[model samples]
Each structure stands twice: as C-alpha cells, then as structure tokens.
Target: EEATLLLRYGQWRLRGASPDPDELQILFELAAMGGNAQACLELGLLCAKIDRQGERIFMEHGLANFKKALHWLERAGEAGVAQGWHALARIYSRSIYSQRNLQVAQHYLEKAAQAGLVEAQCELAQVCWRHRRDDPLNDVKALYWWQQAAAQGEPTAQAALDAFAAQPDAQGWALQAQALLTDKLRNSSPFLSARIELAATFGLTKPEALLIDIKAADYGHCLVVDICAHHARSKRRLIAVQTEAQRATLNRVSRLFGDVDCGFDGLEGNYRQRQYRLRTTFPDLG
Candidate 1:
C-alpha cells in the first residue's frame, strides 16, 4: 500500500498539472525507497531528460545526478523491469553526461528486447543499421532486429525494413535514418501544416479557415487540426481535422482524415461578423 501510494505520487508529479520540484523529489525518493520499480525508472528518466531549454539539470553536481539516474535504473533492472534496461540503453547511447557507449547500450538493449520490449527491439535495429563511433555497421543484425520489432507491430521498424528490402545498399535510407537520430521526423507538428495545405489544395478544407488550434492524438502519431470556417453563406462551421496515416510516416501524398465539432477562444464571440470579414479579406480562399 505504501509502494502504491508512492507510485501514484510519482505519476502525479509528471502529469504536468503541477510544477512543484520539491513535491516531485519527495514523491520520487519515497517511491524509489519503497521499491517501486516504475517509480525508479520514471525518476531516472526525469533526472536524465534534458530540461526545457535543452540543458541537463544538476550540472553543478558534476554528473552526480546522472550517476543517480543510473543507480535507480540499476535498481529497477534488478526488479526485472524491461523498461529499466531500455532506459539504461538510451542513457548509454546518448551523448549526455559524457557517457555515450554504443556497446554498453547494445548490451542493455539486448536485455530489454529479450524481456519483450518492442521499443528496445526497434532501437537495437536502428543501432545495428547506423554506423556509430567504434560500432561497425551490421546490416544482417539490423534486418534481424527490424524483423523482430516488425513482427511485434512496430511501424517504424517495418518502414525501415521495407526501405532496406527495396534498396539493399540503403542509399535512400541514410537521410531518413539520420533524421530519426536527430528527431526531425519523430516530431508530428511540422507535418500538420503540410497536411493543412493539402486539405486546402484539394478543397477538403477552405484555405481561409482560421487555424485556431492543433494538437496530437493517438500518442502523437496523428494530428488534430482545429479550425473555424464558413461552410455556406448562411453558416459558420468549426471543424476538427483528424489526419490519419501510418504512424511516423506522413508523406505529403498520403491522405487520411476524421472530424469533430469546432470550439474556439478569440473567435467565440461575434462569430458571423468575424467570418464575413475573414471571407472578404481572403476572397480567394472560398
């Protein structure tokens, strides 16, 4: 019961509903002390994760906090949590804290994948394919790990495997792989604007529709584009544009969608008047 409560506190700390650092530290420490493996893992992740400005926390501690992350991760690993091993692998693989060792990363990834973690399998596959420092490229191992992840329904691994099958030399895949390493394609918002443009070009959505809000759905795989537009001379429509595509693969040519009712902030009052002014100002959009 104590462990459970501590775990709940740890989860609440990360919910972003609150920003009390002392509360987070208390929860994480209590949970970790109570032998909650998930808490240990989350606390380790919290410590390891770069701050909002892309800087590591506790820098003055001289990697003391990084070592603390590793300590908690090791404790979680001892508890037989596959995620702990995976997190350890990520920490080892990253250049953070002056400790980027691909071999050690691969070792932990093997442990995580053996314990049935799909993400670990995918990361292992990418690591195998990419030529990292002192780690020789191994396409055979890459294909093997990719097959493992794909069989478990990992779409990124499936896409990479398809790319490999199409071009054994992996010429076209280099750019894509590099992009993934730096997290360009992993980000979903940039694609939303492209999708919006496509919707306007095809008359699916009017070009002049005021883009009121946009957010991610399905764990950041799909975009929800919210807009306000005049559907007819007599009425204004607020629509939620749900773009559907294979996860992590949003080619400009790919098409998918759904919708929901519109809700807006600034445009909530004088809706018709604003709609008329917008339509008149952007006459070409309708």
Candidate 2:
C-alpha cells in the first residue's frame, strides 16, 4: 500500500506544470524497490529516457542508465507485465542503444505477443514481413500475427490482410519448362535441372531461374527473383507461392543451393556463363 501511494504521488507530480525530475525519480525508485510492478515498469521507461539524454552528455552515463532500464524492465516482465517485454524489445531494436540486437528484440516482441499484447502482435507482424529475406518462414509468421492482431480489431493489421488477399495468384508457366526437362539433362546438370523445376513451380523467367540467389529469394509465401546485378536487362519481381507444389519445390531447390554460392564470383560463374550453360543444355529453348 505504501508503494502504491508513492507511485500515485509520482504520477500526480508528473501531471503538474513542471515536476522535479529528481524528486519523481526518487519516488519511483522507492515504489519500485518496494516491489510495485507498475512502479518498476514506469522507472524502467524513465531510465530509458534518461539513457537517451545521457547519450549526448556522457557515454558511460548512457550505458549505466541503459543497464538500469534493462534491469527494472526485466523485473516488471518477470512480474507478468506484458508491456515490459514490449518496452525491452523497442530498446533493443534501436541502434541508439549500445546493446542493440535485432534477434534479441525479436525474442522479446514474440514474448509480448504471446502474452496477448495487441500492439506487440502488430509490431511483430511488421518485423516478420520486413525481414522475410533473413528467414523464409517470416512471411508465414507475419500472416499468423497479422491475423491475430486483426482479430483484435487492429486497423493496420486488417489493411495488411486485405492487401495480401488482393495479390495476384501464381500463374501456370511451369508446364512448358517441365516438358523440356529430359532425364539426361537431370542427371548431368542436377543443379540446373533443380533450378528449372523451381522456375516451373514458381513461374520464374529463364534469367531469374539461372541467376537468382536461391537462398536469399525464398520468402516462404513468395519468391523474390532479383538477379539485376548479374542480368542487367532482368527486372526484380516476386512470384507468389500459392500452391503446395511450389512450397515443396522451393524447399528442395533451396537445400540444393544452401552450400553453393550463386554469385558471379562463385562456381556458378557469371550471368553469361549460366545463360550459356542453359542454352547448351536446352538448345531448343527460347
């Protein structure tokens, strides 16, 4: 009860025209040390603000403030405050923090989302979508979290879902490529054959199939065929992965290219070499 009163008094001071920062901090610290979870969270946020301000004054002071913020926020999170994890995630996501770490931020965001924080769900969905190139399953995770946030009446999440639903379905361009894959070609150039199969499955053009960085292009829900660096005439595009066959084929092809460098300096050689190899393998192809 004493901690709760102190917290209330600190909040009342904040409502004043100009409160004393030192006094407020002392009150918050007293409340937090008295085991008030909300006070801990508030103190953590206050310390984080101080840390940011300290950045312009003293590097050591900034680092110390950040450590204090992290400690109190962790305490709040352990006390089951969902927003504490969200706050920690926001801190870790910013480069201003000396301890900035995207992977750690993602972990805390996930924790907040699982704890039923709607804002965390929305933010996590955006993070997954934005960084899909780093993890192929991120798109799938994005969809899941967006769905969760939308169900909670988040307008932005609903808008994203609507946009996803409006995207064009994958076309049927694989049949022609499939007909060209002879057994001899499959045995002799297994890598090229796999690329052809992936192209057929995902509707990739000849150049995209030959020159795309396979590992970097697979975004689970879509294939980002960007080979513009190697093929100057080729444009970057996304092929939606709408079918089970496309997913399976992508998985297989990605595994094949996992250990192989698909860049110009790698064993695959430059765009011209790959194109020449493709033309040599399938002389009748357009």
Candidate 3:
C-alpha cells in the first residue's frame, strides 16, 4: 500500500515535472509485486512501450518483457480493474504483436464493458456493428452500447448515435433515445435518467421488436413509462415499464444490454412530477 501510494504520488509529480525514471520504475515494480492493480497496469504499459532512451529494456528482455506485460495485465484484470481489460484488449488487437487475436481482444473488451468502461462499451459496439468476427451481426447490441456510452457523455458515442440516426434503416430510434436524455432529466436524477435513457434506446433499437407506444404507468410513485413493443418475427406484443426502480426493469434491459447489465438506480420522480402525456394505449406485460 505504501509503494502504491508512493507510485501515485510519483505519477502526480510526473504530470507537472520530470520524475526520475529509475525511481519510478522501482516504485512501480514494488507496487506491482504488492498487488496494486493500477501499478501493475502502468508497469505493463511501460514494458509494452518501445524504450527509446537506449535503455534496451525491450531489446534485452525481447518477448520476455511483452510476456511479463501480459502477466501483469492479467493480474490487474483478475483484480477487477477495467483499464487492465481494456489495455489487454488493445494489446491483443494490435497487428504488430505476435499475440494478436481479435477473438481474445473482443472477449477482454466485453469484460471491460461489463466492468463499466465507457470506451470498451463503445469499442464493443463498433465490433458488433462491423461484424468483425464470423459471428452473426448484432445491430441491436451495437446501438445498445452506443447508447450506453453516449448517455455517459462520450463524444464518439454521441457521434455514432447521430450517424445511426441519419441511417434510414436505423428507424430514428437514436433520436428518440437522445431526446429522452435531456439535461433536465439528468439534473433530476443522473443515475436514473441514464438507466431510463438506456432502456429507451434498447426498447427502440431491438432488431426483433418494433416500438409501438410509450405511456404513463398505471401505478407507481416512481416516474414510470410503459413501453409497448412488438416482436417483428413472432408478431408478439410485450410491454415493459421504464422506471428507475429495480422492480420489473431488468428482464427487458438485459435482453439487449446483456445479462450483466445491472446498474440500477432507485430514484423516481422526474416522470411522475413532470407530466408528459402521450396518445398510445397498449397491452401491459402479462
């Protein structure tokens, strides 16, 4: 813990002034060995980078350094650091590395996304959209993550959402999702608003379903909007209430965002207090 603290202090110093690389290296090594995930990640990155100062670190160690970097990265990931998974994904995706594997890369990216890394979510969405693997394309998933990142104020994700909105086949669901993510709603409850926005995006973007209507919930103190969606393939109608409460929210959101999607906020008043009327009546989820 001392070593990790020192390393963080050294890093903070590095932002303003030049710190001795030898000293920093020793601190990183100490902290990394002590199970500091951030230190391990930093050390891994240092090992992976080309040492231009004739230190001959990579040259002397050869692939040993790269392998060590992967070791530390895995350790960091095992410790539940999202950045570790993201870094590993990037390293595995790079063509210059002999260890390049898109499948492994995608796996780590998904792990990072599961850990709530916005960049990983955005990248995974792109991967889904591009159908980079032999696996079936999932535009719904692509839009889902895109909405996730966009709701978190990621500019790239916002641009992607805009692009999707421009596509005729996208059905303007992105626009609807964006509309629901207003600052007013965010101010009322950032956490709940984000979840509602996510649900809105998921409901509208489902490839198998067509959004039919959105109306006020029949009962609830929480701001709940009943979403009526019809499955295009099965011609089945389903209704999901978009609310901040954990009660009756997961099944629908997870259908698009994945089983790991569980970031729920219990704040609900924006919808209930500020009335927004609609002209749609649909069957409730039965």
Candidate that would win on lDDT:
2
Total backbone clashes of candidate 3, pairs 3 or more residues apart or in separate chains: 0
Among all windows of 10 consecutive residues in model 3, the one with the lowest summed lDDT is 277-286
How many steric overlaps does candidate 1 have? 0
Instruction: For candidate 1, list the clashing residue pairs, or say none.
Output: none
- RMSD, every candidate, angstroms: 21.3, 8.8, 13.1
Q: Clashes in each model (backbone N, CA, C under 3 Å)?
A: 0, 0, 0
Residue-level lDDT of model 3, residues 163-231, one tens digit each, is 444122343543354454667755654433444444444343432222222222212212222232323
Error of 2 at 261 (Å): 33
TM-score-sorted candidate list, best first:
2, 3, 1
lDDT of 1 by residue, 1-286 (tens): 7977887866765667655555666787788888888778767766665342234554443343668878887888878888888888877877754888978888988998877788888877677667533342354556667777887888888786664332212232222222233234225333233333333322223322233232222223222232334333423221222234333233332433223222343322344654554345334432
Q: Of the pair 1 and 3, which is ahead by TM-score?
A: 3
Candidate 2 global TM-score: 0.54
After superposition, which runs of candidate 2 have C-alpha atoms over 4 Å from their true positions? 50-64, 165-286
Residues 65-97, candidate 2: write the lDDT tens digits.
778888998998889988889888888887888
Query: What TM-score against the true fold does each predicted structure earn?
Result: 0.49, 0.54, 0.52
| Residue 178 alpha-carbon offset, candidate 2, angstroms | 29
